[model samples]
Target: MNSVQEGRVALVTGAGSGIGAAVARKLAAQGAQVVRADITATDGGVVVDVADPRQVDELVAGLGRLDVVVHAAGVDDPRAKQRIADALEAGRPPEVTASLDAEAWRRVMSVNLDGTFHVLRAAVRAMVPRRAGTIVVVGSSSAFDAPAGYPHYAASKAGVHALAQAVAKEVIPFGVRINVVAPGPTDTGMAARTPAVLRQAFAGLPYATPEQIADVAVFLAGEESANVAGAVVLANGGRFTV
Candidate 1:
């Protein structure tokens, strides 16, 4: 409940559930004028599909001005952990490319990679004019150490991290900072889709809750990390070091 972000206009994408929802709530609780954006409407946010450039543009326009942008919208297509396990059991490689359907790959890419880009582009377009803003991209540990059977998701998140670094450099002179927060296997709907056996196998390792990731995002958006830029902070409970 810090008042540091009070009166700032913050926009969070994919805010209907999971990490996105948590980030949105965290920002709002800190007194920021939060504009929760997602494709599906919820009690605290508006519906917005970040993959759609036009929608992103319209959202920024509706906000008039934005000081913080948090991109968290993502999708896991054909979420069937059993199918993944079955494929592996049948000697098929445990890789997304080994068995991921064409539509599934496309869906994941569109939502996670393209969606992040669209939101970032829109945020930059608006923030550059103001010459002051911050952006926090919600990446995943998979970007650094991808597990088997989820190449699409991993690759897309890797793109997100790269984009954040590039944008951080490009916008630094504009008084805007951009960074990423990569969370490990988090306890969210996305993680719940994994097979029970696989989940159990990874149970010993620490899994972060959505709130912990959200707190990191808040730090990135606030002024405390003023000198930080082009950085990817890992909130994975020691799962990956970078």
Candidate 2:
């Protein structure tokens, strides 16, 4: 790919591993100065929990000059996953809303939804002053497709997608483009830990590599996608026809 992002400054959250790490690597390769942020910092990355608004604000403010931002930090509650697994084992559907664990739900939302807001808000504020920026938020197909027994994950991602769309409209006038990439099942450490029954939902389908998803994110962040805004680019391998 071309170094279309030459000389730009980019920030990618959740850069410790998985898709976030891939995105950070790709952005750097495209000639951008990439700042990697995560709860657990690595590779000279800044340590910050996106769920904390103050930390996110500090991270972006310290960047000095921001042009591209990719919000990929998120979590699927392990407690909820355990509940779903136990349900499946009992030959029953996963726990419904009534029986869902409140703490688990809040944990997922804090990171996946609230965290996204903090990062995106900080990035946009920094970019609005310059009137030139692009943000790519990593969402999930579960937002639209609704995975069984994972309300917290689904709700958080759905909120993320909506947040991107709403913010995209608000910032376009200031030359900032915010978009979402809703990927389906991907080959990542997070996916590897999912219960077997849940994984089988995409049995016949091939899992997407982190690099593949990163490619889409990079495209959205570059000049090639200049006209695209408030769009959710689905990279779900044809799992959902709609």
Candidate 3:
């Protein structure tokens, strides 16, 4: 019997590592033709920085038949993340909002928020005409429960949730479904570098693996989630009941 994704064409950004890589591999294993994209050429993936709208548009436009699109490319400046982590560990508050580093904030917004918009816009344009497609955005649990030290990351994800919701409505009538999978901290390279003290904060809390999150994303992208649309599925390891 043919699998649900057999012969389907899918695009996954940030396919170089972590959740994005996992999503790409799962889709391929399920028999989908997965196009891997990332800011770097890791794994010989297409090199396109989501932060650039032109690159995102071109990448989507070039995909002849896009049955599914998972926008998973995202970043957090490790230096800034660690600096705030360190301050919080020492019982000192990180800089106030007014004094937050402007560049760092802009960098996160550009890639997380603006980049999401660019990818969604381009994907919708391609999917609407065909009147059949699904989109799964990798979001952050921080958007629901604010983070202690990373306002930029939290804010960007919150914006992503809203954007996906708004756009989902507009596209559902055209047979395209858009949803978000917001996961808590997973065992990714980005999380591995987090300060020990910070990791300790969630020591006993539920932590997830990249594959686990990928399972959720793939589920939402396929027929199983056909009735699901414009929803944010939180895979945050029992952190919050909501």
Error of 2 at 86 (Å): 3.2
The runs of at least 3 residues in candidate 3 whose Cα sits more than 4 Å from the true structure, single-residue gaps closed, are: 96-98
For candidate 1, lDDT tens digit of each residue in 1-242?
55988899999887888898999888888898999887887886787887788888898988898999988888874464566676666777554566577888888889899998888899999898889999999998889887677788888999989988998999999999999999888899878877776667567787788999999999999999999999999998886597
Best by lDDT: 3
lDDT of 3 by residue, 58-153 (tens): 888888889999999998767666777878867898764655688989999999999999999999999999999999999999898887667888
Clashes of each: 1, 0, 0
Instruction: Please list the C-alpha lDDT of all candidates, in the order they appear.
Output: 0.86, 0.90, 0.91
What ranking of all candidate models by lDDT puts the best one first?
3, 2, 1
Which scores better on TM-score, 1 or 3? 3
Better of 1 and 2 by TM-score: 2
lDDT of candidate 2 over 1-242, digit per residue (tens): 65778889999998999999999999998899999988895888989998999999988888899999998898887666777878887898877677777787888999999999998889988999999999999999989988687777998999999998999999999999999999999998898888887677678899999999999999999999999999999999998855
- Rank the candidate models, highest TM-score first: 3, 2, 1
